[model samples]
Target: MYFGASASALQRLVEQLKLEAAVERIKVSQAAAELQQYCMQKACKDALLVGEPRSCALF
Candidate 1:
């Protein structure tokens, strides 16, 4: 019974890792798109207002 529970826990861990990896990939893709947009636009003060804290703005 103990062995079975250990195996089941391992399986759950593996599945969670797979899901985390997929989430990471999605975030990277979104960041790439945001960066591309930031680059294509001007870096004027108006653009700086786009993202937040002002300084964190990409454009």
Candidate 2:
């Protein structure tokens, strides 16, 4: 029973990680879209976008 439970838990954990990674990709793409929109606005206002921009660097 313990072995079965352990295997089940491990399978669930793997599934969760896969889901999280998929969600992370969605989030990073969203963030990049937002960042691009922001930079475009900033550029329009200042002619040169500048700042310690946010990172969307994935693991």
Once fitted onto the true fold, the runs of candidate 1 whose alpha carbons sit more than 4 angstroms away are 1-5, 24-59
Number of backbone clashes in candidate 2? 0
Residue 37 C-alpha lDDT in model 2: 94
The deviation in Å at residue 48 for candidate 2 is 38
> How much lDDT does each candidate structure score?
0.71, 0.73
* Candidate 1: residue 46 Cα off by (Å): 23
Q: Compared with the true structure, what per-residue lDDT tens digits does model 1 show for residues 1-59?
A: 44657877988988998998887445878999999889767555454446545454355
List, in order, the clash count of every candidate structure. 0, 0
Q: Highest lDDT: give the candidate number.
A: 2
